[model samples]
Target: MFIVFEGPDGSGTSTQAKILAKNLEKKGLKVFTTAEPSKNILGKVLREALQKKYELSPKAFQLLFFADREQHVQNEVLPALARGEIVICERYNWSSIAFGVSEKVERKFLENLSSSFVEPDHTFFMNISAEKSLERVVLRGEKLEHFETSEKLKIVQEVMLNLAEQSAFTKRSTILNATDSIETIAQNIEMILTPMLFLQNIK
Candidate 1:
């Protein structure tokens, strides 16, 4: 299954993704865990530009993200999924749509561009308040990235919530409360996902 996790920064996606992948591996299932703005050359350059230099126009940023995603899909995601392995990605096309639309990109164009890519079989939307998520970021003592400000993060959070509510992507999406403890939240996600994995195995 192509499972993607979406949320604002500091939403514990990385932590949970690791735990879930490990648990799945323990079950004797092959699992591949990765994230966007991947560890590739193209992805690394864009990630550095975004985080350190803050050097991309809104349109350029969107395109670079998609480029990284395209490379990631071609080189990593598709291969694992084809082998009947579970592919857990930290972010997917929805991240671009949410971020792009917030940057004033036309919604229709963003949606169409994103739809051209493969959609996740199931997406876990880690829901949290903008204020709370920001606080978590601060507590982590990380340097501010281009999207770190309260204003920009608020916009991203709003876009994510709005998409979760209205986008067709939500059909295969599972909403998780991110404000809970890590263990509780992880358990909740596992409860929702374990059955899906079992069904796939039977088929």
Candidate 2:
């Protein structure tokens, strides 16, 4: 199964993804956990450009992200999934649609671009207030990247929610309230995923 976690910055997607992967592993499932921008050379360059150099235009960023994703799918995710391993990814095509396309490129073009990639079997969108998300990021003492501002993050968050609601791929998606306590959120995710995992085992 391929599962993707989507949300804005500081939305606890990383935290929940880790928890879910560990729980699945403990269940004796073969699990692989990864994220994007991936650790590949293309991904590394894109990550640096996005955060440190700030030289990437919106179209450039979008294309770089997709390039990294193509490499990621070919190198990591698709292989694991083909082997019937449970794959968990933090962020995916949805992030590009929300942040890169909506802000800079046309929505229809972004949708078409994303359709070329492998869609997740299940995606979890962690919803949180933009203000709270920004606060959490600042509290973590992380340096603010060009796209890390509260305003931009809010727009991305809204776009993600909207896209999830409207997209056919999101029929398998679950929206979780990310403002809740960590334990509570984890429990909610487990509740949603465990049954599906069990069903897969039976199949």
Candidate 3:
């Protein structure tokens, strides 16, 4: 199964993704964990461009993200899935939907662009308030990326929440409370997934 975790910066989604990977591994499952922009050359270029505050237009950014995602899915996601491993990704197509819209790119365009990729088995959206999330980022003292601001994150949060409510996500998506303790959040996820894991085991 391909599981994806997504949220604004400091929402703890990445942390949860790692914990969940470990949890699955503990169950004797082969788990693969990855994040975008990937560590590969194309992904690295996109990451550096953003960190350098390059003035990329929304269209330009979307193009680069799509390119990186294509390579990532082709080389990493598909291969891992073929090996019957549980693939957990920190971000995926939903990111394009959220961030693309935030950058004024048409949402339809992004959805169409990403339609070729395999759909995730489950998508966990770490829900959190913009103010609280921003506080966490400030406390971390990391260099601010272009989309790390409260204003942009607030919009991203709204987009995610709206998508979570849509029928496209209906039973396949989860909105996790980001305010909870890390252990509690991880336990919640494990509880939700345990039955599914067992079902897969039986098969």
- lDDT tens per residue, model 3, 146-174: 78888888888898888777723458888
Candidates 1 and 2, the one with greater lDDT = 2
After aligning candidate 3 to the native by TM-score, how far in Å is the CA of 12 from where it should be?
Answer: 0.4
Give the alpha carbon lDDT tens digit for every residue of 27-141 in model 2: 7788999999999999889878867676867887888888999999999999998898989999998898888744567777777898998878888999887898899889999
* Off by more than 4 A, model 3: 167-169
Model 2 — which ten-residue stretch has the worst lDDT? 162-171
Candidate 1 per-residue lDDT over residues 1-203, each given as its tens digit: 89898998888889889999998888777888999889999888887876767677888888888888889999999999898788999988778887777677776777787887888888888888778888999998988776776776777778887777665354688778889899999999889887787787722
In order, candidate lDDTs are: 0.83, 0.86, 0.86
Query: Cα RMSDs of all predictions?
Result: 1.8, 1.7, 1.5
Candidate with the larger lDDT of 1 and 3: 3
Error of 3 at 118 (Å): 0.6
Q: Candidate 3: which pairs clash?
A: none
